[model samples]
Target: MKREIVLLAMFTMAIIFMAGCKQHGTPKPRGYYRIAFPEHDYKPFNKKSPYTFDLPVYTEVGDGAQPQTREKYWYNINYPNLNGILHISYKAVDNNLNEMLEDSRKLAYKHSVKADAIAERLFISADKNVYGTLFDIKGDAASPVQFYLTDSVRNFVRGSLYFNSVPNKDSLAPVIDFVKTDIVHLMETFEWKEMPKL
Candidate 1:
């Protein structure tokens, strides 16, 4: 009788355990946290510089934070909440327009090893005298976007976007898209300040 009782209990426990775990376990895929992006808005950049543009309200402009002495008119448009920055460098055309254009191309193409592809788009505004190329770099490379704006006569400027964190294209796609719009806006509103007559 005792043996039968023990056998019955063992059977009952086995049945309960089997019923509790009826389904097979499956692994869950990894996911990234959702980011709440802010509304896109712009205000005219109010700094003393050779050129002017409408910058996103979410940014603050400051001198470049480099170890070496920074050049005049070189500034950084900082994205405080996003941990990103747009480095802006200005140069007088000085009859070296070809050299400057080549340099910009080299700078953008340097990331091509890590980048999947790079798209070059021409930007021209005869009214504003802003003519240059905008490079949209794709992949897990640094400086996903870079551009050079120049009147092709007197003023030339270059801008590059970078983030403080590691470059993860999958995770950063949304933020990158968000910031790309602002860069386009800056380009759209770019205008060179009138030079004083010598």
Candidate 2:
């Protein structure tokens, strides 16, 4: 009788274990953490510089120009909370307009290897006399947005957005889109300052 009771208990335990091991349905895919974005309130960045634009109230501008390599007008629009920076460089066109445009195109395309697609939008402001192109890069590229604004004359400005962390488009998409709107606002309010004659 003890032997039979032991067998029944073992059988019951085995059935319970098998039932526990059976899955209910298909497993859901992995998910990432949620991101919180700030409001889009902006303030004018009209410092004593070669150009002026509207930057997000949450951002701070720093000198991006290095003593060794970068020019005087290079600046970085830093998003501290978002961990991203938009490097803006200014160059005066003495006659190298074509070369400058070519270089801008090349710099933007360098990410094409990792980028899924690059969409170019031509920006022409007849009132502001600003003519240039904005490059929106899709995918896991290091720099997902790059643009160059020129009067097609004297002032040429190139800006590229980069994050401090690893390039994960899926995770950074919200941040990128948020910053992109700020950039668009910058572009809309962008104006060239009159450079002093050297």
Candidate 3:
């Protein structure tokens, strides 16, 4: 009789264990995204002549998505390593250098609806004084954007995209830090020849 009872208890315990295991199935491990940058590679500046620089291998350039707009030059660069797309744009705001500078400044750091925008300063280079500002929007609507620009005569600029899934700005600190130096390198390497009159 004791042997029979022991066998029954063991079966009951096994069943309970199996049920519990199913009830709390082990979770698939979360993905860990490490920061991996590609070896430097690049092509000559497409729009401007007399400038050359290297960008990461994985980066790609494409025609700007918006064409009907008034912007002069617009290009899209996909940075897969960063899981985002960056937009490089140029537009003649007012044809005045000072006005352009002011507009860029406003785009960098003004956010009120009535105002232009808001950007967080990330890095600045000494030689070209290239500065970076992160433009962050809020909500499920859209995380925000990142844009770095220079008032240099040729109107050079660069930008990057983030996954938007996790955008603490703190979490993005690593890539932002890495790319800022790259941006400065690009700015310093920048050279623009006067466009020949048509």
Weakest lDDT window of 10 consecutive positions for candidate 1: 64-73
Off by over 4 Å in 2: 24-30
TM-score of 3: 0.54
lDDT of 1 by residue, 1-198 (tens): 999999999999999999989978899987887989899999999887888999999899998736586566888999999999999998877899999999999999999999999999999999988998899999998899999999988888999999998998988889999999999999999998876332
Residue 75 error for model 1, in Å? 0.8
Q: Report lDDT (CA) for all predictions.
A: 0.91, 0.90, 0.53
Candidate 3 lDDT over 48-149, as tens digits, reads: 422234555567767764656745456666666676666666543235656655665565444344323343555555464444444543322122455555
Summarize candidate 2's per-residue lDDT along 48-117 as a digit string, tens digits.
6778888789988899889898577788999998889999998889899999999999999999999999
Clashing pairs in 3: 110-117, 111-117, 137-144
By the lDDT metric, which is better: model 1 or model 3? Answer: 1
Task: Write down the RMSD of all candidates, one decimal each.
Answer: 2.6, 1.9, 6.4
